[model samples]
Target chain A: MHYFIELFFSGLTRGAIYALIALGYTMVYGIIGLINFAHGEIYMIGAFTSYIVASVLSLYGYPLFATVIIAGAAAVVWSGAYGYTVERLAYRPLRRAPRLSPLISAIGMSILLQNYVFLAQTSDFISFPKLIPDLPFMDRYADYLGSSDVVILFTTLIVMGILTFIIRYTRIGKAMRATAQDSTMAMLVGINVNRVISATFVIGSGLAAIGGMLIAAHIGQINYYIGFLAGIKAFTAAVLGGIGSIPGAVLGSLVLGLTESFATGYVSSDYEDVFAFTLLVLILIFRPSGLLGKKESQKV
Target chain B: MLKLQNLRAGYGNIIAVDDVSLEVGQGEIVSLIGANGAGKSTVLMTISGVVSCLAGRVLLDDVEIQGLEPDQIVRRGVCQVPEGRHIFPQLTVRENLDMGAFLRRDKKGIRDDIDYVFTLFPILAERRNQDGGTLSGGQQQMLAMSRALMARPSLLLLDEPSMGLAPLMSKQIFKIIKRINADHGTTIFLVEQNANQALHIAHRGYVLENGRIVLAGSGEALLTDPEVQKAYLGI
Candidate 1:
């Protein structure tokens, strides 16, 4: 029973990270209907940006919390840049082309980005120092979950809240929703559809970057290859929740995260990937629209 | 005022609107009427900057706007109520209207305009919270017109505003368009397949066929002209 509570909290924390990254996938897909395979590399870039920032800040005698915040901010900026450039160079030109070409380009971009990072930085899995200050009640709190897990959960909730606020109230948010609903209507109404799409990518990538930083801080280590698997898992979560829904992404991530933890706990870890894909396949078969996704009707 | 000179537009090598030239003066309701594939809608799109013009010039009040982007054209007070009533399916009526004024910063005026639109189309007020996609076809047409009006545009381009509508509903929409013009004095350039209804309220009219302006005259004159009668009125 105690271990169950522990596993539950641990799963929730991991789910938060997945949810954050999955948002990028859902948001980009919502606007442009592209899978944006290179989005994962944005996650990888974010982790490295945070690692470099925090490490340098720590060496310069900055406090742990301060350094972590700065690193997190840097991660957000870098990931936003990554998303913007990818949209302008990789995806925008192919707007009128066949779908397959853009999908292939996205994959090519992923490979290119991963290799670029690998060449620029060392191939080794570098560690991000423990910059988050652990509370004194850490072990006592861990009767159910770790402090970092609590931090992840709280951060996810806050970010999700802010995101909801933005989507529901602000002008930019309205533009994004309009673009998602119908690009032509948005353009006709003077909503810069391209700008909205770019903003969606930026916001999504920024979220993923923030998540990457948090995960790196919690685990204290990361590598370039980390993004590939994490990206797949996040994509799975996005599709599982419904590719266009914000809440769906978070809920799907939690389910995927819990499933991963349990698979490792009760079964061989080797079967984790198989289990996630199996769940996705089942979802596709049983409820093709997704758990929360409302099925859209074709007008003509 | 909007003017087009020798406008040649196409979708690929197969030309849809060819070498068309026409003008819509300020504060007048001008209607473009033709059959399917007659390029009535294509002329509006080229003027609205949705489709590129292969050759010729588009001038809004003598400011050349031939190659401008769609949003820029819209920003210059040219709002297009697209064919098919392309309202954002997932958005609410309020959000759709807000997007019409997306580039504007006048908060109080925007609020007032929203109120006015509600008065113009009370059903939109009732369905303000409903998603635009779920509205009935007639209601969607109303929403699209309302959204275009939200921009307070100088030149409103309406493409097939009566499309997919019952006869009674189409009459009601046209009545509202007349009311909007009378009350606001907003210039209108309307496209429609239903030539009879389109010419009913138009101050002047142009007839497009095979991507060219086959005829142009005052609305009543064109409605009675022997050429327009044979070609468009099917008399």
Candidate 2:
């Protein structure tokens, strides 16, 4: 029972991070129907940005909580800039080309960003600061969940709630939903479809940055290569949830996280990646549209 | 209010509207009537900037808006209620209407327009909270027109507004279209397959056949022309 409880909390924390990252993938896909293969690099950039900010601030003797907040904010801004630039420079030009053209461009972007970071930053792992301060009282419950896990879980819930509110109530949010439904109609209605797509990437990449920062804090280290594996897992989560559905992406991430946690806990950790892929394959075989994806119908 | 001069447009290389030229005067209802493949919708699309003009010019108030993006054209006071009433299926009727005013920022004016739209189509008011896709065919058509009106456009391009509608509903929609033009002084450029009804309501009309304007005159003149009487009026 204790082991199960421990694994559940761990899974929940991991799922929250995955959900955050997966949202970027799902939203970009929802609006533009592009997979945004370079999304993972955005996450990596977020972590690195946070690391740099915190390191620079620590030299000035900033405390842990303040450092964490400032670092997260810096990461959000940096990653958001990257997201907008990637959409404008890399993806925008290929938007009207063959669909496969953008896919190739996205893959190319991912590799280029990865190498860019590798050359700029070190290939060796960087030790992240302990953003979560030590809580002596919670040490007794450390086996069930750490203070970092609790922070990650709560922050994710708050951010997700805020995101839901923005999408539901804001005018821009309505425009986004409208554009996603039918861009031609959206354009005719006077919504700038290009602006809406850019906004999606900006918001999506910001969320990914938060995810990257939180995960870096939790795991105690990050590297340029961390984004590759983490991004693939989050992409899988988005696909599982239903590529275009926001709620579905969140649900899918949790499921993927729990699956990975339990697989690692009970089964050999060596086969963790194997188990995740197997589950995705089985889900695809049974429900190809994904768990919450709408089945497309031919209008004509 | 709107002018097309020697315009040629199409999908890829296949021309759908070739060398088509027409004018829609301010505060008047003008219509383009044609057969199934006569390029009626293409003409409107080219004017609205949805389809790029391969040649010639589109002048909105004589500024030449040819090849501008659709949203830019819309911002310049032309809004198109496209064929098939493309309402956002997942959005409520109210949201769908709000989307029409997406580019506008005047809160009080937007609210007033919503009230005005509701008055025009009371059914939309009743189903304000319902998803637009759930509306009946007639109701959807009403919603589509009302949505365009929310933009407060100077020139409203309505394509096939009466398509798939019952006679009673189509008549009601036409009455409202006339009312909108009269009350708001909005210039209308209508495209329809129902030639008799379209010409009956329009102040002037053009007959488009295979991407060219084969005939043009006052609504009554075209309605009574021998070729139009035979080909369109089915005399």
Candidate 3:
């Protein structure tokens, strides 16, 4: 029973991290109908940005919490800037081109960003500073739940709640939904569609950045290549729930996380990737549109 | 209030609208009637800046607006209810109306306008919270018109407002169009394939054929004209 409880909490922590990254994929896909392959690199860049800032601040004798906050803010801003630039340089010019064109451009961008990071920073796995401190009250629950796990879960919950509010009631949120539904009509109604697209990229990248920082702190190490595997897993989560639905991404991530945890706990950790991919394949075979995805119902 | 001179525009390589010149006076209902392949919608799209103008000038109150973007044109008081009543399918009817007022910052005025549109189409009021995709065709048309009205446009460009609707619903839409013009003193540029109904409401009308304006006159004159009757009205 203790083992099961431990696995469950671990699953929840993993789910929380995956949810943060999956949101970026789902949102970008929702607005533009393209899989932004470069999104994963944005996550990596976020991790690196936070890593550099946290290290510098810690070296300068800043308080732990302050270092964490400053590093997080820096990560978000830089990731957002990169996201905005990627859209402008890579996707915007090909907006009217064939759908396949932008997709190719996205893949190219992902490779370019990965190489750029590789050249700029060392490929070695640098140890990350533990930004989340061990809370005093968590000593009793330390056997099942760590302080970092609690922080990850709490942050994810708050972020999702805030995101829901923005999408439901805010003006720009309405504009994003409107553009997703019918961009032409959105323009007729005076929405700057380009600006909305840029905003989507920035917001999505920011979420990925937060995920990057949290996971780096939790694992205590990060490298330029960390984003590749994490990105694929989160994308799988997004596709599992429903690529274009917001809540679907979170649900999918939790499911994926729990499945990986239990499979590893019961069987072996060596087959973790096998289990994740097999589950995705099974889901695809059974429900091609995804668990929560609406079947294509285009009006003729 | 709106004028187009020798406007040329089309999808790449194939011209849809060529040398089309027309004028719509302030507070007047001007209808452009044509057959299926004629460039009526293209003309309106050119004015709205959805289709880029390849040549010539689009003047709104004598200011050139040919090269402006679609949203820019809307900001300048030109709003289009495109063909097929392209309502944002996932949005509720009230939300659709809110999108119509996307650029407006006046909260109280937006609220009053919402109330006014609800009154204009009481059916829309009932379906205020329902997703726009779930509405019936005629109801969708009502929502589309109401959505455009939320902008409080000075010159409203309507593309095929009566298309794909039953005769009764078409009559209702036309009546509401006239009421909107009379009530708001808004100039209307209406494009329609249903010539008889459109001409009846229009103060003046133009007949477009194969990207060219072949005829123009008072609506009553065009209605009685033999050429228009044979080609368009089936009279």
Candidate 4:
């Protein structure tokens, strides 16, 4: 029972990271019909940004909490700029091109970002400093739950609440919905469609940055390639719930995380991702629109 | 309220609207009739700034609007009820109306206008919270018009409002169009292949054949013109 509780909390914490990243993917895909393949790289950039900020600020004798806070804001702003640049340079020109064109461009952008980071930040894993006050308990949760699991669960809940507020009540939130629903019509009604699209990418990338930073800080390590596995996992979570649905992404992340954790804990660890892939395949074969996505039908 | 001079535009290479010139005075209904390929829709799109002009000018209330983006066009009080009733399908009827007033900042005025739209289309009020996609064809048309009206445009460009409805529904839609024009004192630029119905509701009408205007006259004159009745109106 103690082991079960520990695994459950651990999975949820992991799931929260996936959910954060997945929200960005799902939101961008929902409003603008592009997959935004370089999104993963933006998260990697955020982690690196946090690293640089933390290192610089600590050298100046900044407190750990202040360093993390300042670094998180830098992550959001820089990642948003990264998203805006990608939209302006890569996706804007091909807006009217064939769907495959943008998809291919996204993949190319991903490769370019990875190599760019490699040239700039080096390819090897680096130690992520302990920014959070993690007082590890060897037996506090061993009899009830794991100490790491508690931090993971609590942190995600706070992040989720903040995200939920931003997406629900803000004026920009309404604009995002209008842009996603019918862009042409939205444009006709005096919406700056381009601005909204840029805003979507920025917000999505910013969120993914926070997720990447959290993951790096929690696990104590990050590399230029860290985004690859996290990206795939989060994409799976987005697909699990429904690609365009925000709530769906969150639910999907939890489901994916729990499934992977249980599989790793009880069954063979090697089969964890295999189970996720299998779930995706089965869902696609049976419910291609995803578990929460609505099917669009043409009037013609 | 609106004028177009030598407006030429297209999707890519094919010029859809070729040297099309037309005008709508304040509180008048001007209809453009043509075959499917005669560029009626292209003219409306160009005026709304969705399609760029190769040459010529579009003026709304004496302001040059050509070369502007679509949203800027709407801000100039020129709104379009596009072909296919492109209301946000997933949104509720009320939400669809709210999106129309997206540019407006006055809360009380917005509320008043929504109530006004519901009054104009009572059936929409009854189904305000229902998904826009669920409304019947005629109801959808009314909702689309209401949504456009939420923008409070001086000029409303309607494309093929009677496209997919039954004859009875089409008649009702035309009647609503006439009423909306009369009550709101709005200038209308209507594009349609339904020459007979369109002519019935216009103060003046023009016929386009092969990307150019071939006929122009008062509504009654165009309806009775022997050439128009024979080839275009299908008498």
Candidate whose DockQ is highest: 3
lDDT of 2 by residue, B20-112 (tens): 989999999998999999999888888888888999999988899998888899999999999999989999999899899988999999999
Order of the predicted models by TM-score, top scorer first: 3, 2, 1, 4
TM per prediction: 0.97, 0.98, 0.98, 0.95
Report the error of model 3 at residue B150, Å. Answer: 0.7
Stretches off by above 4 angstroms in model 3 are none
CAPRI tier of model 1:
high
TM-score of chain B alone in model 2: 0.99
Lowest lDDT sum, 10 consecutive residues, model 4 chain B, at B14-23
**Which runs of model 2 end up more than 4 angstroms from their true locations?**
none
Model 1 misplaced stretches (Cα beyond 4 Å)? none
**DockQ category of candidate 4:** high
Error of 2 at B48 (Å): 2.0
Per-candidate iRMS values, in order, are: 1.1, 0.8, 0.6, 0.8
lDDT of 2 at A147: 89
lDDT of each: 0.89, 0.92, 0.93, 0.87
Give a tens-digit lDDT track for model 4, residues B21-102: 8889999999999888888888888888888888888887788999998988898899999999898987899888988998
Candidate 4 residue lDDT tens string, A189-297: 8899988899899989988888878888888898998877888889988988889999899999998888888878888887888988888888778887777877756
Q: How far does residue A126 in candidate 4 sit from its true spot (Å)?
A: 0.5
Question: Which is better, 2 or 4, measured by TM-score?
Answer: 2
Evaluated against the true structure, the overall lDDT of model 4 is 0.87
State the displacement of the C-alpha of residue B233, model 2, in Å, after optimal TM-score superposition: 2.5
